[model samples]
Target: MDDLSRDIIRQKYPEFKEIPSQIANGTKYMPYFKDCNGVIDDTLIDVIIHKENQLCYKGRKETPTIDVLQAYNFDLLFTYVLSGWEELAHDSHIFLNTIGNPSINFPKPPPGKYYLVDKGYLERKSYLTRYHKIRYHPSEFCGANPRGQ
Candidate 1:
């Protein structure tokens, strides 16, 4: 099933061949993210495991789950996916492990480019994360601009 889904997505959307038009030209996502290639994140998907092995997969969620790491472009097409991690694993740990292991061949951002990540991951050379305690989502900017910290 995984192979089928991946094949279908690959055949339908095709991999991002170059910098997205929005970022390439001075359009909507320019200035702030002109050098951004894409986004990377991880999610926990509920899964059924044998009773004996359930303990290792149990985490915050009531049911067992597997952490799936995915990287996608601004067009919302998945460029890469690494799944089957136990739910108990931390997102940072999984991210580091994936990049450290040469066999995986993770899609690293080009020099001077980066991937926008959420608070779950740390800020690094090619990965940019929000400042701690700062409001990021637009919804938080209600009515007028934010006041002094």
Candidate 2:
């Protein structure tokens, strides 16, 4: 949907916009999923907002702004939110903070698979074993130096 339509919907239903949908086969499914083998998975998702503007000077300066929203998902059974921020000229970061929190209440991972993540999700071996969770920072911002370091 376009920005205008999304904004209208969001205004009408603020909480509705934050609810995560399970996407499969080009359809929005319920947040919970169950497989034939009696396995269930709970999806964790987050949203990011980006703003762009056009500057114009017609006797009086004016700036028009547009906002875009992006959603991302990670395996909650093995990850958590570490950090998320907007980059100056690149995609935003959706850092996943890993945790060892027991998965006793959650569905089990597929056989021989502890967890699964897309390429955007970062994984570190040292941290995985020690923390039992994965941390992800968008690749584009990896090389940028810290503000005061």
Candidate 3:
């Protein structure tokens, strides 16, 4: 899906030499990873619950859910996927449970490179996040939004 999305961008704009890490002018220096985020997806409910609070969330309605974390590169190819976590788990908790374990966490990015994450994740030396309350979406200001909503 990420590949398909990137392909469409290249197709529309053939002179795709450089896409800034994050920028209208410039938001990041080179040796940086692209944006990545977590999302909750509805899944078939099991008869039992691991925790009482894992029942359901408003965002996902009454169905059980799983939190999926994915990372992507500048070309929007998926670099990683961390999943199989309960829906009610805090984003930070899910992250901590994954990173410290050798079998799960991958090697750290090279010294200067960092992954852009959502505000839920901590602002560590290895990762960066955008302003919490700011509107970073281009469509917010320009009516030429792609969503067509």
In order, candidate lDDTs are: 0.72, 0.26, 0.47
Winner by lDDT: 1
Residue 85 CA error for candidate 3 (Å)? 0.4
TM-score of 1: 0.77
- Which pairs clash (backbone N, Cα, C closer than 3 Å) in model 1? none
Best by TM-score: 1
Model 2, range 37-132, lDDT digits (tens) per residue?
A: 111112222333333322211112122322222222321121122222222211112323122323212222333233333344445321112123
- TM-score to true structure, per model: 0.77, 0.18, 0.55
> Tens digit of lDDT per residue, candidate 3, span 1-149?
01222233122222223343343233333233232221211132333445665555323555556566655544444545565566666776655555556666433445544556667776676567677877687665576422222
